[model samples]
Target chain A: MHGKRVGQWNGERTYLLCVHCHNPHSPRFKPIKPLPPPQRPSEMKR
Target chain B: MSQDPPCTGACSGETAPDPSRRTVVQFLAAGAAVASTGCSLESFFRKSFRELSPAQVRRYIAELEGRYGRKYGKTVTVGTAGPMEGVKFGYGLDLSRCVGCRRCVYACAEENNQSRKNPQIHWIRVLEMDKARGVDVNHSDIYYDAAEVPRPGHFYMPVQCQQCDDPPCVKTCPVGATWKEKDGIVAIDYDWCIGCRCCMAACPTEPGTSTGPSRTSPPPK
Candidate 1:
């Protein structure tokens, strides 16, 4: 905050960069099937 | 391609457009190959060296260690133990102080040993945001060198990976190529990178970018 403005993603033991996640490591990450967003309580029928 | 002047807007003389499907396929494949080669920078991230077999991971690591030693004139200790998983770096920005001169970008390029041929790759990108909307990055150019201040209400913001505690990119990685280091740096093993462009989609930045190519080196003494 005082000098540098960069931040990284925390993965407990390993650090991640912008490309790390978006670029991926291997088959561990698969194209996920889109699921509907969680239903909002306010939008639910009263 | 180099001979061709950067094509400008509409009305540049066009050739008989042989934009065939084969051409498109070739372009895509070539792009993929280039992406893989560039990703070699992520030596530690990938399980193999340039897509070598798993049996070769150790040999590849040994070679990399040797290179690091020669390149920096020091031994780089990489042990047989796999890197402990799950570490992350936290970062933030106070846009008010950022002058938008892009010093940080150049610094990152140098620190990371990016390709000298292309100076755009690296860990940071600075932006000169408009006075109206301070966060807009798509249109801002840190390359601008006008002799002025605030750009009539301009502000500077130097940015890199935010290293979110819960990173979208981390959750999205397929092979676990990206990892958080104990020091909180989210590093990529360029070799592990697949050029799938998923990380680009997952990044939180206004317009996500993946840098490659190091800055130009100064003349020898």
Candidate 2:
């Protein structure tokens, strides 16, 4: 609708599939352990 | 007292050029040329992807393949494929099926070869929000940690490049490093990026795009 295609239509293809990115069982993204923050300039050794 | 003073080189038309100064100038000029020869001036003067001709694109791809091959000690192929005619990409997600597991987050990072360490870069961000609020961004939490997904009444929403028809990121880019492609994909030319973070500021979705230190050499063993 309004130049935007909604719901998969015939003669159209998705660049990527949902299963390619999301698993059917657990579609939610898992929590990630963030990397350590960068060191402060004052904390650096000369 | 009435006699004229010695010329002392002041009354002379022009002073003799200093041989040492001339030699230094020549040496500097030669040194600069030599230094620049080692660096690829072709890359510095290379035009943007949209501006490059077919022949130039091929040459650029070859140069990239050679550079990456040398760096990785393996044959590397740099694809120069253009968008397909009459084909545009659209992405959709089913919120009802989403469980809030961040598998896509890691998948995207690995697929894009994002930097893993030092300055860790993730293009997609999954935010946890309360169901009652109904997509209130101010109340959403990106750092939510839970033992099991679909926690109580919380819902997950993953955000990334919207690939807007009129992208604000592209508009705010002072150097035109990022642009919207014909396939409805937003592309960033890393070489043209100046790390000014102007695009980041212009993006409505915070953390839509990420910037970090580029990995130049092979990671430490």
Best by lDDT: 2
Give Cα distance to truth, residue A2, candidate 2, Å: 30
Given the true complex, what DockQ would model 2 score?
0.08
lDDT of 1 by residue, B49-134 (tens): 34545556667777889999999999797766645566333676667555555556656656655543432344565566778875
Model 2's CAPRI class? Answer: incorrect
Show the lowest summed lDDT stretch of 10 residues, model 1 chain B: B1-10
lDDT of 1 at B63: 83
Error of 2 at B97 (Å): 1.6
Candidate 2 collision pairs: A28-B99, A28-B100, A28-B101, A29-B100, A29-B101, A29-B102, A30-B101, A30-B102
TM-score of chain A of each: 0.28, 0.43
- Candidate 2's residue-wise lDDT over B1-221, tens digit each? 12222333533686645656655665676567756777544553453124756666677788899999999999999887767787877666677656667777777767777755444556777778899999998998766766667677988888887777888999999988999888888889877888899988999887744565545323544
**lDDT accuracy of residue B55 in candidate 1:** 50
Docking class of 1: incorrect
Mark the regions of model 2 whose C-alpha exceeds 4 Å error after superposition: A1-46, B1-81, B215-221
